[model samples]
Target: MMILVFERVIVSLDLENGLYQEFSHPLYDYEPANRITLGVLRDCLCTFSSSEKFSDVWIMKEYGNVESWTKLLCVPQMGGCGCYIYTKPLYISEDDQVLTYFFKMGKFSLAVYDSIHDTLKIPAIQNNIHDLVPEAYLPEIYFESLISHFSQD
Candidate 1:
């Protein structure tokens, strides 16, 4: 039972007095795939965070501010029935701390951030894995998205 609390991270742009807008959030009452809304906002940079984990999370410009940015369109490997390959890589913003946790649980887990070193190529993780986190843990993707939704304000 992995969980993902999408944090509202502000990407610091090269522009002066840069501010962050809502990055990722929870998709309550939406389709299964919509459970998590993960992506990079174009045209700006700032910090983002979810209250559930790594409260101080931020997504700084890894390279430099461009005319546009990317947002990873990712989901648990098990839930990629409708995911597009073109947008898959973008979904994984290494700066997204939320992915660091859930991906530790399953094979299709963690499209971006990785907790265990050498965990690069999606290792085989069984669905509903509990070895990493406690049994009563919150669903990784949803929780993280929800948290990101809440704190982005």
Candidate 2:
């Protein structure tokens, strides 16, 4: 299994035998090690890195292969939203649209990024709670289970 350690190095661990080896990607060379965020996209290991000017998303097309790392998306840091202090990719639609969560300057928002056209869109969401604090809210993806809740006899 692939795991990201504190120093921004990717480590492969063999849980069955308790052995692990560390590896580094060239993408980590240019960016600050602490700013890199590791995640999974399309069932593959992925990473998100950001700078003051842009944010990049990378996917490892083949597991355990350093050369298989491919840049999936690069989003420019645009106006209004300001530079993203934090970015988390939540989902990717069939049309190559990426649903991402971003937090900046005490506000959190969701944006849909179209890789085909290189565009970003913020969807309109209705907020019912007037006392909601942005810092108190955290967004996450929910996976539905196929197994029924009833006990098997």
Instruction: Score every model by TM-score.
Output: 0.21, 0.73
Over the stretch 47-102, how does candidate 2's per-residue lDDT look in tens digits? 88877777777888877677889987776676555636547788877787888877
RMSD of each: 14.0, 7.1
Tell how far residue 146 is off in model 2, in angstroms.
18
Q: Write the per-residue lDDT of candidate 1 for residues 29-127, one digit (tens) a residue.
A: 223332232333322232222222121222224424332343322223333322122122222344532334333323223334343331234335576
What lDDT score goes with residue 96 in model 1?
A: 38
Q: Which candidate has the top score in TM-score?
A: 2
Off by over 4 Å in 1: 1-34, 37-69, 72-129, 136-153
- Measured by lDDT, the strongest candidate is 2
On the 0 to 100 scale, the lDDT of residue 7 in model 1 is 49
